[model samples]
Target: MNNAWTDFLARQGTLPARTAEGATVAVPLTQLGLIRSRGEDSAPFLHNLLSNDINKLAADAAELNSFNTPKGRMLASLLIWREADGHLLALSADILPALLKKLSMYVLRSKVKLSDASAELALAGVAGPRTAELLAAAGLPVPAAPRRHAPAGEGRVIRLGDETFIVALPPDALPAAFEALAAAGAQPAGTDAWMLATIRAGLPLVTAATQEAFVAQMLNYELIGGVSFQKGCYPGQEIVARTQYLGKVKKRMFRVHIDAAEAPAPGADLYAPAFEEQSVGQLVNVAAAPQGGFEALAVLRTSSREAGKVHVGAPDGPALRFLDLPYALP
Candidate 1:
């Protein structure tokens, strides 16, 4: 366990496990890890590799991006931010080592230096309707919109969505910062609660199980600003662009609720009667809903989603009902 996290939980007591409308939860994001790319060539090096236009990333901004295979399958989805001296990419910790190695392979003559910065930096999720107010009361500058960040004491505060923000700071500063946040009305909740919020927000994270499963569009990456259509070629640029311009995207990620006893794991296949024995969709992420059962994001063939009922595990398994996503699908 992280010492700062342990200390925070010890001081704040156990927070309410359920997600409520006006409550603010302090979530320990231990499952996610960070990678730092530093040097004069950092921007161009990443620009040549990721789906988004990294070259245009502003100093105070962050963006959703992806690393894809040459065939246009997504290998990893990332939340990239700019720092004073480097760039930070946050993704599933389970894939961090392999992703770090994969990214290093393309360095060639670039001056960029990649390192796992997870140990050096401590991250926490602060979310709810009171998120901005609580952070502002703690003397942190609150970002006004998604993808924007502001300095907060010795760390930084990044807005992930309307009422969601991430706090990134040095390990030494975590305890005091968290203490202030708790005192300012942020409840201490487990990471599962945070993941639930992420799913409800329609954010899809790439995990080890789902690596190289779909192209950017199939996951609605472009709809959510994860892809830059105007940017120059990267590894899977041709395929991504072709899908955007010439080919029609048949599969897309959707928000849905499953009335199952257990939350389905990422990459679990979803079945529809129309598809018979073949899988028509795959789970991207799932979290126990505060209301009941489970909520998840899945990428499914458009025809299947429209023509037949979806189920978890098999055709006769627990049924899944589609929920409206925060944004519209193109």
Candidate 2:
């Protein structure tokens, strides 16, 4: 969303070509949408709608949450954290406008102001073993560990997980900020580099085509700290509760590798011949793997997954080789 940084990346020819191992890489996270919520009742307003417990959010910690439809289908996945004014919610830009409009409808009498800050703010995705050291040198209060954040003047530094960190600051400060980081031995990359790291991190955000197509569990939200079973009622609480209480999650998202000529789109149908023409799953997130072929996260039927035979487009399309997810499943 930072036009200037986008121009910088274009003119600099830093479009991420490969996520080389152990290299410090930085990219403008233009694919994400930033929503700023400020008001006396901002917390309560969002607590009543999101899948996680907003009341328990801490000033220095981030929470992964989802905006679900009443029927328990996920519409958007959010990485929420506190800011000086209120809260900052980062999500996929493709679904932001529609999701923001739908969320505003419930504001009826709340003293909440939800503004799209994507255009006003700049996001930088930095990943590498030296991320913390480089960021601290850039005057950012580099977070101590994953899921933690620290304030830095008008900007904020968050360590998403492991070596991956995101910095949110005013658009005008992006060029200087990234210049400092890159000078500190960081490689400037494209958005694709960041997207690949996110996939390996086992995080999924609802895109337009996949909206309302999968529940929180199907995305492995519970296992990844995106849901709170003890939290009070929110939209789709009952259905989410029922799914949790049920015997087991029959469908789930998994990390897989497909050696195809081209990567498939999100929400594309997946098939297992055992199902015989019945779609067994849908692709959730996809990116071209740096190591050739494409790596993706897809929701698959437990039975199909157990059968160990799933393909894309059709039963005979590209065969997907199962891969390990960063986190363990229940």
Candidate 3:
């Protein structure tokens, strides 16, 4: 078995368990996460910095956005919400610290308070055909809109019909929820399994390596609804909007198959013959592919991407076979 598969099986039963080829991982997040937001400054503060329109987020709703630099490179990808007390921001576990630090620096005078909520929440990914049934069994109401979250604070809830959600539960309440779900036939999964679902979903995660590297659009943020062009200005909003409206994108994220024994680490360099020693792109994330070899997501320069032969390193590096993503590029 490949490392990805092995890792998946090993993490099975934990929140976000690893699963078989294309299987989804469901994790319990109660004690594993935390949730925090600004009471008054939550919405406005987030609106000013995020690539999406915060004002548009309805109560009991969720919005996808990116925290990008002035150059349009994304610092973090976020799932923001309008909770009872304030707004919530959900990001990959790895980028939370950096995100909090950056947001804090920007809050200089703003009334927003940022906290790592991963500790208090139960974050899980539910992939596979049975996700909806499992969620419904758990009492999580199905979301009417795809990629949306609804109000499920006090009781069990479901959303998007099939997609599992990350829930913030008091530490004491998690065991009971997990037990209930387990009794309902929901299996426990690990982080890697969740990662597979994320890849299948075509969701791009921000890691330390790819931080401040590509603009939100370069990663297909708009196609995934991570960018809101009509929203007011935020950091790098101009560049993101212009690129989309003018079709001036020079680089883009892609899914590829690697017939190698090694899994490429995030932020690894990618090269092409046309670029010689100069790098044409960087690896965003990688996992052992179920079909064979390795599969990964990468952001490549437009010119180099057109060449088709993308290498994981210098010219002598292993070859990468391009794979079709679940979504279309703009």
Best candidate, TM-score: 2
Better of 2 and 3 by lDDT: 2
Predicted structure 2: lDDT: 0.86
Instruction: Identify the leading candidate in terms of lDDT.
Output: 1
lDDT (Cα, tens digit) per residue for candidate 2, span 143-226: 887889987668788889988999887777778899999888888887777877778888886888899999899999999889
lDDT of each: 0.87, 0.86, 0.68
- What 10-residue stretch in candidate 3 is worst by lDDT? 1-10
Candidate 1: TM-score?
A: 0.95
Q: How many steric clashes does model 3 contain?
A: 29
Per-residue lDDT tens digits for candidate 1, residues 76-165, read 999999988779999999899999999999988999899999877889898888898888887777998899999877678999999889
Cα-based TM-score, every candidate? 0.95, 0.96, 0.85
Q: Score residue 60 of candidate 2 by CA lDDT.
A: 93
Query: Could you tell which candidate, 2 or 3, scores higher by TM-score?
Result: 2
Give candidate 2 misplaced runs (Cα > 4 Å).
Answer: none
Ranking by TM-score: 2, 1, 3
